[model samples]
Target: MAVSCVRADPRLVEFNDIKIGHVYKKTVTLFQFTAASPAMVVVPGLLIPEKQEEVRDCLLIHVEDTETIKIPLLEFPKVCSLLVDSVLDFGCIAANNQVISKHHPITNKGTAPGAFQVQYSRDPLVTVSPCVESLQLAPPSG
Candidate 1:
């Protein structure tokens, strides 16, 4: 004997394909629905339209509970590269050290150019050149 899977009730599960680099949202209004054993809705891997085989961390879904759970699928592209460190630190400088400075770069590892703003605390001891400002990064092609 072979076990045949049945289609989910249309009234229960509903989903639509989303586009990359865009946002998709749905509002589900339920009336007096009881879920004895709430089931977790897990979305495995979201397909990338451009490169179907390539898998990237782009979509995220959050389900609160069983009955009143609101499933909103968020889709976003790799607009900004991943920054391992947000704060750049300069090691303690010697009292006699003439010049104490550090060069930190905000790299854009994403497919598109990443926009960033630099901000730092006001400290008389430390000097930050190129005051906190907005800047854009060219997309890397290597």
Candidate 2:
């Protein structure tokens, strides 16, 4: 038996301008051409369980079979641009066991919100404040 997509393209599913840390969904409808013989359409392991359920509910098939079709899902995230100083330098430090501090500024130049992360340095003496892994900055206009 031959199967084909009735409404949408079966080869690819594309999503555009998806925000980070957000969920988006799309459905593709498929039709089985021949009804004489039974056929099964399988969606492979690329998607999570929740997404699999969504696809299964939309598919028109009779029984579970080994025939599988791999569909590529493309997602484009919103872009965010950030500007920062090229270098941060501490001029000099005395051996008085004192904690000297400096300020570093990060500016978001893009319209979307930007997420920044400061990785830990190899030197144990060097540390970062607001020790979280990621921080989000709003757009300049906001």
Candidate 3:
């Protein structure tokens, strides 16, 4: 029985600045040449975690009656960038027992999603809307 295997195309795949709640995809191709009546090839899949971290690994492809082939994979750490206004001015207000509101915007400028919270404030009168411990912001689209 004679059998041969070819290396995967694009031998290495790199994912850079991947963000949580976002999906990235890659494809690899493998070729085989054999004279045997029946041949089998196995390709493995990868599963990445949701947390932000760096990953370096490889995929193993098994070919019957042949040596295993290796394809390298690299994943960079997640990054989140945000931009906020320097100052927010509420202006002057009388003590007439009236409610006042102001709008503040936060923008995400990085490739990954980000979470933020208003942890501290000196004045008791100051408050933020949607007062949740964690607020999620999606990355900007290109």
Top of the candidates by lDDT: 3
lDDT by residue (1-142, candidate 1, tens digit) is 4332212112232223334544333333333323343433343433344521223232323233422333333333445464536667777768685876778875656544445555667877776776644445555568
TM-score of each: 0.38, 0.38, 0.44
Judging by TM-score against the true structure, name the best candidate: 3
Sort every candidate by lDDT, greatest first: 3, 2, 1
Question: Which stretches in model 3 have alpha-carbon errors above 4 Å?
Answer: 1-3, 33-48, 79-142
Deviation (Å) of 9 in candidate 3: 0.9
TM-score: the better of candidates 2 and 3: 3
- What TM value does model 3 have? 0.44
Note the residue pairs that clash in candidate 2: none
Residue 31's lDDT in candidate 1: 32
Give lDDT tens digits, candidate 3, residues 76-124. Answer: 8756676778887778877577777888877776666676666657878
Candidate 2 vs candidate 3: the lDDT winner is 3
Tell me the lDDT of model 3 at 99.
Answer: 79
Candidate 2 stretches with Cα past 4 Å from truth are 1-78, 131-142
Once model 1 is optimally superposed onto the true structure by TM-score, how far is the C-alpha of residue 116 displaced, in angstroms? 2.0
